[model samples]
Target: MNLKRTFGAILTILGIVGVIWGAYAFLAGGDSVGGVSMNQFSSVVPFIVGLIFFFTGISLIKGTKDTA
Candidate 1:
């Protein structure tokens, strides 16, 4: 088992969940992004972080050579 790959998979999964949650929360809040209040802006954080996590995990997994 590749530890890095495993960790990457975990990150990817978390990223997916976070993105879904953030997008849903943000959209469901019924406020346009341009009109977002400070409190509403909080919902966007997960989305940005999720994108970072998703890309980081993907790169980590792809760049890591299989030891086996």
Candidate 2:
């Protein structure tokens, strides 16, 4: 596999992990590391990260190969 494909895979994994972690933080109500609620704006970080990862993965996967 090419470097782009490898990066795409890694990004995909990171996206999935981020989504899961975000969902957990959203569902499992409790105090965060800083004694704050996980459902706060900071909690959205995971979702955003996940989205970034997902989009990057898609872009990489869509890239073309010019070898002939």
Candidate 3:
């Protein structure tokens, strides 16, 4: 497999996991830090980041497949 595809696959898997975990955290209520609930902002951040990673990885994998 091409390097791009390999990396993309890894990113895709990680992104999926991140998205699931983030959603769970957001719904279940994440841990608190200094009296502030992490679900307030932290969970959202991961979900957004996971989306980015997922899309980027898909693009990379598709682009590589087309070229190869």
lDDT of 2 by residue, 30-62 (tens): 547335567645677887899899889878877
Judging by TM-score, tell me the better candidate of 1 and 3: 1
As for model 1, its CA RMSD to the true structure in angstroms is 5.2
1-68 in candidate 3: lDDT tens per residue? Answer: 58999899888988897788678778766676345467646888778888888988999898885454
Candidate with the larger lDDT of 2 and 3? 3
Off by over 4 Å in 3: 31-37, 66-68
- Point to the candidate with the largest TM-score: 1
Worst 10 residues of 1 by lDDT: 31-40
Q: Which candidate is the best by lDDT?
A: 1
Per-model CA lDDT versus the true structure:
0.81, 0.76, 0.79
- lDDT string for model 1 (1-68, tens) is 99999999989988998788778768767554445443456888989999889988998899899987
Residue 50: error of model 3 in Å?
0.6
Candidate 3's error at 28, in angstroms?
0.7
